[model samples]
Target: MMKKTLTALLTVISLGLGGIGFAAQGFAMGSDSTEPAKKADDYTKAVDLIDDEEYAKAIPLLEKSIKEKGEYADALNQLGYANRKLGNWAAGMEYYLKALKLEPNHLGANEYLGELYLEQKDLASAEAQLAKLKAACGDCDEYDELEDSIDDYKDDNNIN
Candidate 1:
């Protein structure tokens, strides 16, 4: 009888410690955050819509996320992408600049901003964004994509 009690106590202690560890990990990962998740949900939905090429639909969701969570660089970057896809150059530029202002090292924003520059045929400006990307995340996909774009632009325009 004593041995059974000891075994049960040990099991309870082990389970309790494991539960505590799991809770701590969740909290550290923000899964157990006290903050509301609506803003994150909005951003996630916007990203899904963007993935589907529904830029028009994603705009409002991203805007709502930005309104709820001010200075959210990711949402702002996606907003810029949506607007750029819709051919709203000025709006796209505004959002991208705002995001970059908040987080200058944002890889996606820098890449999209560079693409916008390329759209305007401003090779110098595009190259400047590429340089920033290279400095921020050396040899990253953003840098590679922008470099490819610059190369394509140069080839297309017969520019050395």
Candidate 2:
């Protein structure tokens, strides 16, 4: 009887540990409502590269991630960002447009695209993107950053 109780207690402990393991995995893969779960290894590496300001190195990884994950909006946004940082304006715009096509409410894409417009001195286009960002996420960092960029651009250009 003692041996049976010991076995049962071990089984219970094992089951609890299994549950915890699965939950941890879910959290690591970003199981949240705001963003989709991203499980691509290349995507993660590319994000790290981008964080380090290695835009050129991040491009191929981002491309591989898109190929592996089937064109996720976040990956496309990162592609746009990398290209923009490298001064590939047309390519950056194309990637941003693709990302927006996939996920219209993508905050990063909107904010970055707005900045791109500002770079080209297209204040109206930039403002349009800002409006989209505001509609997508009211009172968010992306909105505030884009708004500040717009203000700075206007100030520098003497727009008003």
Candidate 3:
């Protein structure tokens, strides 16, 4: 049921620069993208591995995508998530932060990074990441919901 739960969030999910709540499904990466479509394909494959809960297998594929296109921020963030799933928190966060640097307003980066902080019970950092998501996703209708979720998480964890 974890995949189902995640699929709901990923349906129109995005941790992107625009915060526009782009769908991470259907097209895991841009299909008809004129620029480096190969990278997109590769990224999609990496994501499929993640969805299947094959984190270790996904890592090399993700790394390949990154190698092909160093600026593939999407792959970088996913790689971070994959790392986190494997319980390598530090390396996972490093990739998340790296992706964030490339895309400052990336929603996924902020959310996941906040989650990392929350896991560690670092309320301040978690708050900062979640707080910034609002501004980062200025046009996204889901921001309200996502904000509420983060707030609830913080509250449940006694973050404040």
Which candidate has the highest TM-score of all?
A: 2
**What are the per-residue Cα lDDT tens digits for candidate 2 across 1-160?**
9999999999999999999999998779652122544537787888899999999999999898778668878889999999999999999999999989988999999999999999998999999999998899997999999999999999998888
What lDDT does the true structure give each of the candidates?
0.88, 0.89, 0.75
When 1 and 2 are scored with TM-score, the better candidate is: 2
* Model 1 C-alpha lDDT per residue in residues 18-126, reported as the tens digit of each score: 9999999766754211244435688888889999999999999888887777757788889999999999999999999988887899899999999999999999999
Clashing residue pairs in candidate 1 are: none
User: How does each model score on TM-score?
Assistant: 0.79, 0.82, 0.68
Candidate 3 — which pairs collide?
15-107, 15-108, 16-107
Error of 3 at 51 (Å): 1.7
- The stretch of ten residues in a row with the least summed lDDT in candidate 1 is 30-39
Colliding residue pairs in candidate 2:
none
State the lDDT of candidate 3 residue by residue for 1-160, as single tens digits.
9999998777655545235434445346444222445465677788899999999999998888778776556787888989999999999999999988877777777777877776677767876876788687764543554566668776797766
- Over 4 Å off, model 2: 1-39
